[model samples]
Target: MAKEKPGDDKSPIAGTQSLDRALEMLITIAASPQPGMTLAACSAVLQHSKATTHRVLRTLVARDFLSYDDDLQVYSLGVANLRLGSEYLRRIDLRRVALPAMRELVAETRDTAHLATISGSDVIYIEVVDSPEPVRIFSRVGDAVPAFATAVGKAILAWTSADTLDERLPETLVARTANTITSRSLLIDNLALARERGFAVDNMENREGIRGCAAPIFDHNDTVIGAVSIAGPAAKVPEQNDSALGKSVVATAQAISALLGASPDAATALPR
Candidate 1:
């Protein structure tokens, strides 16, 4: 008779021990510091006999879920894993992934929170979480606003490449309000400041009576994908309180980025 597998009896569902072991092995291999693991190392880490470990590895290799390096005598993730990851990333809905964090931001700041993506020289509001306060900034989803005049746009633009900035920004930046930065040179300087501080501020630049703070969201590749912002009436979101609000916005943006597979270290890294 064949020997019983580990956790066979303890498993909640019957006949799942093999599947569980296979999944655990995959997780262990993926989390390893080294690029790959030898059969012996994998066996030791799994705390299973070499015979049992080899069987599992062979099955995974056959399914193209893992690859064996003949010369290195090691096993690593294979093309199948990449295919699954690609499918997962492709199906991800950015608006849905960012909604919870946006809600939390609105709760924390008592201001309207927005999730926006860049489209040419404009920022499109894809999602919004309204503040609970009686008096708050009102914004609608699908609203497109000038990129240079808003905190969300500045947050994303700060991390974008120089060529992209030049291509997107027009030769003449039309001012939306008295406080809007119309000069390209000055706006570039402001973006540098935003990159340094990890957040951006709109001090009545986008709208006369509104002020906002925002931070950029990154993806798995460490690219700036979007931005999260909290906006409110100037009285509530005062210029003096920008630092405090900025920290909140940055934290929220980082939280959203984490869901999108961006490491905290990568999120905090300086713009290239």
Candidate 2:
């Protein structure tokens, strides 16, 4: 007979359904496009009764994971989330390792440089080095962008395992802009190109007037831990120079990977 899992009912310590539900609610709230969510709104979308959802929200608010505006009756992520994010970054050493290369990339390209990692189905920015130029893309450290619509996201996804890709990608990709890829087949083709070229391009797909090129960053074990990108106004990032910029991003990523102790051979052999 097969061995029982640790969390089975017969185990010494059983799983907690309420904890699972609370985490699910937290994820839903975190992913909301809007700044805050009302109790009714969260309950409606989560399919949970008002009383149950409210109880979880109250607990989260008390713990500083969520913030509540009593007057507005709205809730949003709180300072505790920021602390957690900081802790995560510190633990991974990604920010510390990527910042120098990111700054150099910005100086070389005169464009905004970003470092991001996958979180659930989204790409979360952990570090950003703004361009010295007057007009540049303004993105925050904790901002989350759709993985299927950004160059950094595509570069990371191209090297992700097939099973993980299926889990991360949605059935229908969200259309962030007119140029966004809505079909999975087309996305696969794009990934193939990224894999072959060792870089990816957004081409103003995530936002109008913005274009980005990116390459993946690997860890000591050759795992793709994140990506680094160069972003700027579409007019400034022309298709004619995309190849050159792609090479620059790929080289920067490789340098960072080396700092993280990844073998050059292992990094180059990353699977698509």
Candidate 3:
């Protein structure tokens, strides 16, 4: 006889009714949009009794994993997701490797530079370097932006695992500026470019007057650990003007990856 796997659902619905109901409810809510599904809608989708669904959602909301909008009667993912992601970074060597390089990039361009990582449906800032120019990048450490909206965010999103991308980038984009790539096809094109050229650019995508560029950084396993970017005003980024700034961002990213024990064989030039 074949050995039974632990926690396997092969023995029929004899003992895990509550767990099954809860998981089904969670999955149903995750599959919905507009912050979340209405409690009635969730019960309908999961085919569970209203009482079971309510009990599960209430417990999850209490734990901070889900939010219930009584006004709209919808349920959605909550702050617990952010907290869990923050905890994941707490165990990693994010600062030891990314900070020094960010500072170096800031010095080179006299513009703000930052290191960011993909965390669920957002891009979380892990490190930041301020330019001496008084004007600076809008993001700070621990700040997050939609993955489809920012230059470094898009770079990391492009390199992320497909499942992760699916969970993160919405089927439709959230428009932050008139130039933002709200179309999924256009964002995919950008992703293709980032993968092909080893860097990414945002020409007023996140903010009306902002422009930025970024590059991916890999770990010892060749996994893209994060991305780094330099951001400034639009008037500064056109042509070779800010292109020079982009080169430095790419260089800083590569250097940090090296510190993380990565040995990239592709282009690896540090901007002068």
- Which lDDT value does model 2 have at 257? 90
TM-score list, all predictions? 0.88, 0.66, 0.61
Model 3 local distance difference test score: 0.77
- Report clashes for each candidate as comma-separated counts: 0, 0, 1
The C-alpha stretches of model 1 lying farther than 4 A from their native spots are: 1-20, 33-35, 269-272
Give one digit per residue, the lDDT tens place, for model 1 in 150-268.
Answer: 99999998988887888768779998999999999999999999988899999899999999999999998889989999999999988899999999999999988988888887646
Q: Model 2 — which ten-residue stretch has the worst lDDT? A: 5-14
Deviation (Å) of 184 in candidate 3: 0.9
User: Which digits, one per residue and each the tens of the lDDT, describe model 3 over residues 1-272?
Assistant: 98977867544387878877766777677667667798788888888788878899999999888888878788998798779766764665967778878887878787788788888768888887777886565667889888788888877876776666678787678788888898878787888777777778888888888888898888766677678998888776664664577677778888888766566753332210
| Each model's Cα RMSD | 6.2, 18.7, 17.5
| Rank list by TM-score | 1, 2, 3
Error of 2 at 263 (Å): 1.6
lDDT-based ranking: 1, 2, 3
TM-score winner = 1
Residue-wise lDDT of candidate 2 within 1-272, one digit each (tens)? 98976657532334676887778888888888666899999999989999999999999999999998888788988899889866654576788878988899988999999999999788999999999999888999999989999999999899898889998797779899999999999999999899888999999999999998999998767888899999999989988889999999999999999877677864457464
TM-score of 1: 0.88
